[model samples]
Target: MELLYSNILPLGCDDDERTIVGCFKEQMKNSDRVEIAVGYTSNASLNELDALIDRYAIKKICLTIGMYYIEGMPERSYHTALRVNQHWKASGIGEIRIVKPFKYHGKLFCFYKNEKPFSAIIGSANLGVIKLEATNRRQYEISALTINETEVAEIAFHIEQLKTSICSGNISDIKGMPLIRETNTSLDGIELVTAVPQSSVEFYKNCKTYVSFFLKLKVPRSVDRHIDDGKHYTKSNINVCYAAPRNKRKSRDWYETQLTVGSDIYRMEGYPNKNEPFFVVTDDGYWFKAHTTSDNNKQFSAVGDELIMGRWLKGRLVAAGIVKHVNDTALDADRLGMITEEMLEEYGCDSLLFKKTGQTALDEKGTDLDVWMLSFVSGNDYER
Candidate 1:
């Protein structure tokens, strides 16, 4: 048995081997599967674990999260977990489960080799201890690493008990659970902006320079037939941008999200130019750098990173509870993966409105750029 303390030394000087993340990685080196039961966790922690899973060639990870039964999980975290589970499920990697009926505050991680428990970490650290972010403050945690065969088996048994159908349920089960509708709204790191009410005629009257377009385009029934007729079909515009093609050879697929703009709209005086990046503050308070590119400057996308724009728009819908969260594994036939006309209609709005705020802000590189506001609120009726 070995004791581990996260803050034995000064903040940044602590030994990486003693920290939760480092300890987990070291254990993963000898194990192919792991089972974790933590009081609470975050999306960042899951992302960290996901990376480790690939790096270590982990075959499976079974996570049983507690605390959500007492204090509802944050909507973002819940949705992120769902998306992560979807990926894992599609890949036959693992599953994430939630405790039920009673609250469990224990934190334990058991690593297995060839389906036999070999080691375990019992501690005070939640899954968040693994995330190494600049903004996250280091937390003090005391845990024990035990390789004793008897102790490892005992701890593994407890976790297995928690996995029983009666004791816990898969993350997907929450969707049908009565308490699933209750989600904590305390979104950390995300700014929530109060949108100008669409019913406010005065606000619309004063906003004349705005451009609005539908999120889901009306696609012809047969794209192949259309191509046969010499029509160029850009799948990026028809489907949600986040699911952009993974074809490395095609420059169009390189841009994750591409929404086609009308020539008149793209040619608007003072609008952003081709490849000229600008800051965008969405009505939902998400901010990103954006630019117009492609032939005729008709493709609007987030500057540099491709997933930013799609995440912003799709994330908003997920938060609104109007759409299900999805990942790259989501198929085109999975309506949950793509923004469909039906989703927009259910959201009570079919288009997004973009208007230059007439403001300027310095980007990460310290370049001054125009700031634009994007609104996708329901009932918003904007003129072309």
Candidate 2:
């Protein structure tokens, strides 16, 4: 038996061999499969595991997450889990499941060779600990590795039991599970609300003093012809914002959502200046830091994060049954076809509206900025 502590050395000085990530990498050298049962996890952790699986040529990895069943998963994590599950399904790698009926808040990792359990790590570290950039605060996790045949087999058997049909279900099976609201706690002592308010009428009435602008989603005839040709404009204009070049090394599937503003729209005086980020509270209650980038400040994007804004817009379309949820196996052209002018028209809205809410909020950096409101409701009230 060997005890492992993640914070034995200073943060930067801690080498791979001194951390849980290092320990897992070492075990993977001789293992063909791994089983993980943890209370909680994040997309970043799954990404790390995905990289390790590829590097080690791991045949199979099964994860049974337990926290979502009891506390409810956040909207971001829920969507991410769905996308990753689809990706894994297409690649024939592994699957992620949620333990149900009762919460199982145990953390265990068992490694196997030749279908036999050879070693196991039992500890307090959730999978999130594997992500080096997950947090800035110092954290300490203590775990023990057991090479005893009997102990290793016992742990593996326990994980196998958790994976059974009676105990767990694939992530896709829980689509009806309520998603916990996402909030930003980065602001000093102030949490930014990210859940849509229940009543739209009441919200607008309360904030009567505001300025609004309607953004029509009209594709130029030339651009539409090019898209139809399946050449440079092969992807839907709606998805062009998400079509940025990804880092091949990281294998990231999404990019920071950017909505290109024309010169006419750019004339709006209150919009954030090029590279000057500000806070935006969506009519649906979600809030994110946004900035304008690129030539003529045409690209409007959420600061630092990729998933938030994309999920916000695309999720609504999915919920309305206007388009199918993203599938990893689908061709890029097919995925692009999912969001079209016809779908937006069917949904009763073909544009988005931005409004100045006549309010102010402090961003993550404690910079006081004007808080704007964004909406994509199905209506023509704001139409020119």
Candidate 3:
């Protein structure tokens, strides 16, 4: 039996970059060349690929560049493929082709020993600066590899056909590729509003009705050492259109993202999503904010500092707690082994804090903290 289809994302992502790149290195170690075809391409991504080719000393390389209609496509063609088109020729990479003016959007890779193909990868990921340079917690891509001889032959044949037909000259030799205007960054100076008033602890506690993004924003001790604030009212002015996990540049259209702490607004962008991205304190203690994943469906389990916040007050460090399903009967105050009566009195919290333990498990409900974290910030920074 042989492995057929395999996931490439977990290979390149998850702090295990060696797996994905190593896959190529291993292939290059045994093979003479690998072919890369992407409807969209960029210089930064190409540079990384070129480095790999050089390191393995893969003798032959070919590229098929195209202009696919996709979001995040570079605005200018020359700034993209055209510039890279000129850069690769000096190297041992001998084969390159440019295709455009057509709605071409496909990514393919074929690795070969001599001229025969042994492995190939195909998918929706564009070989662009964003994909090659950074691996976000999540991306707009899905790719897989097929090592079956039959599949590799079919892929190889397709590449040869593309070269004979659409692959005409380098990006510079092509006529239509042009320079275009640049798009502005959307994250700069954006506005957001709270979905519910900060005091409305019930809004965060009741996951069934609100089922919203759980945002953990840190308030500066200088700004509001909110040792005392209770839950209260609710309202929202903005809606979340997108979320940026820390990887791809955090640029979106107006009102695309919003993270809020007290009255301050922070744009969520180019950051990784973490399971436990909660409390963060700076060196001077002049500024601080809670961190949450870019997920849009997180709910808070009133386990921390809740006893201190009481019924109706506000302060920094007002609440600390675990995340859990509201209906999970195991989530009761007594079931929470960490909190004691004396501790609750000392913290001045009414409910026992439910700190998430290593033994904690994710709820079957779609309330993954990743979804809720982004929602929390976006809602608070949303517009009316």
Q: How close is candidate 2 to the true structure, as a TM-score?
A: 0.56
How does model 1 score by TM-score?
A: 0.53
| Per-model CA lDDT versus the true structure | 0.67, 0.68, 0.41
Model 2, C-alpha of 172: deviation from truth (Å): 1.8
Residue-wise lDDT of candidate 1 within 1-384, one digit each (tens)?
887767534643344447666788899988999999998887688877878888889998899998886677765567667777877888899989988878889999999999999999998888888884553455577788999999999999999999998888888766332223223122224332223343442343354554433343333333231222233332446353323334644323221445777776777676668998887666544556788898878887876666566566666666655566544333434334455555555444656777775567787678999877776654423343
* Collision count for each candidate, in order: 0, 1, 47
Locate the minimum summed-lDDT window of 10 residues in model 2.
184-193
C-alpha RMSD for every candidate: 11.4, 11.6, 20.7
Give candidate 2 regions above 4 Å deviation: 8-17, 134-137, 181-283, 286-384
lDDT of each residue in 1-384, candidate 3, tens digit only: 122222344444444322333454566677788777777665466666666667777788888765532233333333444334545667646655766546456787789987889987676656552234444324445556678899899989887777765444554454434333232222123222112333433233333322222234221222222222322110011111122223354422222222222211123332323334332211111111123333331322121322111111111112212111122222332322222233223222322111211121233343333212212111112211
Least well predicted 10-residue stretch by lDDT in candidate 3: 232-241
**By lDDT, who's the top model here?**
2
